[model samples]
Target: MVDVVACGELLIDFTPVQQKEKPGSIAFEQNPGGAPANVLAALSRFGKRTSFIGAVGNDVFGRFLQQTLIRLNIGTKGLVLTEEAHTTLAFVHLDETGDRSFHFYRNPGADIMLREQDVNEALIAQAAIFHFGTLSLTHEPARSATWRAVEYAKQHQRLLSFDPNIRASLWEDLEEAKALALKGMAKADIVKLSEEELAFLVGSEDVVEATAWMLGQYDLQAVFVTLGEKGCFYRTRNNFGTVGGFQVTAIDTTGAGDAFVGALLYQLLEVGESMLDIPQATLEDMVRFANAAGALTTTRSGAIPAMPTLSEVKSFMEAAR
Candidate 1:
């Protein structure tokens, strides 16, 4: 059985590369990206059986992304190619701190063209975890298609993993975005949030309180809040604690959160879902391991390319300790 099946956008990220020949000019490099795709790739890197379900345009960039995912060991059995739309693209810019800002080129891009009919129920039924983000919910048939997957996962008793990787600018109404994110939380068994997203979702500045509120309000099994370099804070029904981060000089913060999510899901798959309500110490250790993966990802560039293998994450953790 597949350990995880992720559904969402599959696109190219055009990240700026500094030029060596030109004094102050730079060029763009196409990198495979999209939160759910990144998560699947990271899980694949960890040797988990993973698959992705999404649509990409029938253009060259779309083909490239599909090929890249397959090469990364992710199952693309449910990948769709639509001729009606071009592939989605995002232009990413990094600040001095390596934090990223995005300007998307997905005006009716193929990712959003996913329809409920395109979602393969057989593929989703084979997974222990079904993961998704709200980015797919921003438009049309893809929105309903994502919701359909959520329903299928719930029906099959598969764990639902939600990461509200919100791109507010994509939403026509910000309130609608928050509402959709909240709806996703209600269905998720495991919810991953960045510090900012957690605050926005819970309407609080307190990280611990936000985690607690989300778990209780949504009656979720567990909530993990990523705190950048400080690592992640996890709250389960019976236990809660902060995982201390591994030290690293981050070159690009892009995809680090996805790496963290992927690592945690991979560990959960390894340990088995029977003990998901882990002891406090066990949860802390798991988050620490995930933190190492996320940290290592930041030390590199791009999304899928930056993901560390299981051995790399383990080695980095061992050296840190």
Candidate 2:
């Protein structure tokens, strides 16, 4: 039985690394990445039974990605290797603040080639939570596949978790992106958004006002807005509060948000589908642990490679206190 099943892109991230011998030159370090995959990696580290539903090319990079998930103990039975398109590759550029920008080589990537026929309904039916992002919705076939899986999960009474994970560069039109993002939110029982994403979706800089707008417009059980170093704000149907973040010297903020969402979902598993009934204090504590997980992730370099184990997160949280 899977605790969480994620459906979306799986690809390689080429993170920039400065060359020691050649001061002016930069080298790329290959790491397995993709928002949904990173989230599953975090959950696998927490001892959850997680599965991935996506596609990769039948190439070396694809093979590496497949092995990486297998090594992490994240189920790959739903993963597809196709020759329709090459595996997607992203080059990550980090600013001084460790915030990242992406340059993708996915004009016809294998991830977008995932067809509705590729979706595994059995996998979606067995999972307690079905998590997805808008990346797959940026293109065809995969978009239909994602919707099929989402509707199936909904019909099966599974908790739906949505993270917009917006990449402005990936979308051809900003309005279309916003529309599809809102469509995904309407189906989600829980949502995780970055501060910028909140502003982009709602057109408001005020977190309180924007979140209130979300709760009013959507039939959501809970919503989370991550504030980077400052921490996160959470709003459930019954209660709402803020959770302070852990202070860490971040080297790469690549998968911090994914790790945070993964950790939060891990805690949500204990409550089953009763997310709306969680006490404010308990929800705050969960967010605190998730913040620690995210902070620990940024202290390192890669996404999946940087995910902290359950013991590591617990120890870090204890030390912080």
Q: Top model by lDDT, which number?
A: 2
Q: What would the per-residue lDDT of candidate 1 be over residues 141-256, giving only the tens digit for each residue?
A: 99999999999999999989999998988999988999999999999999999888877878997987888778768869888888888888888888877888877887788899
Q: Candidate 2, 164: how far from true, in Å? A: 0.2
- Model 1: pairs clashing at backbone N, Cα or C within 3 Å: none
Badly placed stretches (over 4 Å) of model 1 are none
How much does each candidate deviate from the true structure in C-alpha RMSD?
A: 1.0, 0.8
lDDT of each: 0.90, 0.95
- Write candidate 2's Cα lDDT for 1-321 as tens digits: 999999999999999998999998999999999999999999999999999999999999999999999999999989999999999999999999888999999998999999999999999999999999999999999999999999999999999999999999999999999999999999999999999999999999888889989999999999999999999998888877788898988889999999999999999986564887778788888899999999999999989999999999999999999
Which pairs clash inside model 2?
none
TM-score of candidate 1 on Cα atoms, chains taken together: 0.98
For model 2 the local lDDT of residue 9 reads 97
What's the TM-score of each model vs. the native? Answer: 0.98, 0.99
